[model samples]
Target: MKKFWNWKNQAQTENSPAERTLFLNGTIAEESWFDDDVTPQLFKDELNAGEGDITVWINSPGGDCVAAAQIYNMLSNYKGKVTVKIDGIAASAASVIAMAGKEVLMSPVSMLMIHNPMTIAMGDHAEMQKAIDMLAEVKESIINAYVLKTGLSRAKLSHLMDSETWMNANKAVELGFADGTLTRDNGGAENSNMEDAVEAVMFSSRAVNNALQNKISAKYGKQKQTVVQQSEIPAPETNERNVDALLERLDIIKNHI
Candidate 1:
């Protein structure tokens, strides 16, 4: 709720004209606690306050996907230039919001993370399948944003999301997720309270195959090793008698010689 976002002018001095800059901290939510008053509409209202370029500073562990999607769309639709600066960390849903910026800048030490949308469901077999289908569609939607922003192939973006990829400023720029790294000197455009935005959050990144295998093992127990038994067959009786007869004839021939 209150910890969601902070909107402020980027420039503080009277000599410098007011510049619209939004500092997005903590988690992104569909609505603030209680009602829908503190969501995308509120953000748009704040954005309407000033003219010129809009700069957004994000440092969040990320939250609701729907909210992030709405904010992303709004920023993408904005007429003025939208600049996003990541001062701490933007992961998961926050990463999607980051893509809306016309120019994305990351602090040298900041991080960006992208991962598949996760959800919990309670259902029968058919309902489980439906959940799977819905997740597939959601994953596709997320992939679209990443593909448009990075110009990376959908397959590559999918693979990256599968692994819950994490990127630093330079790496983010290299991957085209960010335009450049921010270099702050004498408190220019950097967040004044950057330390307050820091968060320790881990991505749910255990290898899916490995996890499935472990679950299967736990359910069905490890497969038992098969043992092959060898058996010896005696020579055929007819063949043995024929060999004896041949040896007897050879002995008689030798005796006659």
Candidate 2:
């Protein structure tokens, strides 16, 4: 009898002791769209793999509201602790995902933008009115997420969402959008150069103004002058130095005659 090997079971058995952390990046679209294929599988695998804290880093511009809501719920309900780090920007649906984190962090330069949910539809007036009503309900769902995360009043949260609020890392911390600031350098040299360039421009502008003022003062101080001279008339005489001069005088006399 030959021994049979089970690779799938063997690998799972070996890896079960180690904790796994999955990374989710990019836009969140509709459940029937691209997100369904990627997010659900990843979530299922990560959830089943091991019992460990999951840290999710988000820098998305946001997409389908429904997909974002689903992903948010999944993370929020996960048994293990979830931490979210916003390394760059988290806008629209991305912001909703951030709310799922038990502890949220944001880099100094990272930003968050939130707004009312929206969609386009073409139909009769009644159908259009229904679409408007649907959008209002979706907006409420989004507002609920923010209210849950921030613990702010629903009315206040709804107002901010309606206006499409933008929050920096510090503002995010203050408003409870982010729990705290993360210590991550986004490369300091570029920022230093930008500051230096601004200073140089300001100094150059001052130098130009000083030069213009000096020129204006100098123009007022300087006196204009006009000089003229009349020379005494000298008697006309023929040149006796060379034969060429004599020939030239003879040609002039001939022409005059």
Alpha-carbon runs more than 4 Å astray in model 1: 1-3, 10-17, 30-38, 189-257
Taking the tens digit of each residue's C-alpha lDDT, what string does model 1 give over 40-118?
A: 6777777665666888999999888877888889889888899999999999999999999998988877899998998
> Best-fitting candidate, measured by TM-score?
1
**Candidate 2 TM-score, true structure as reference:** 0.62
User: What pairs collide in candidate 1?
Assistant: none
Off by over 4 Å in 2: 1-19, 34-42, 184-257
Model 2: lDDT of residue 232: 37
Native-to-model Cα distance after best TM-score fit, residue 64 in candidate 2, in Å = 0.9
Query: Relative to the true structure, how large is the alpha-carbon lDDT of every model?
Result: 0.77, 0.67
Rate residue 241 of model 1 by lDDT.
Answer: 33
lDDT of 2: 0.67
Top model by lDDT, which number? 1
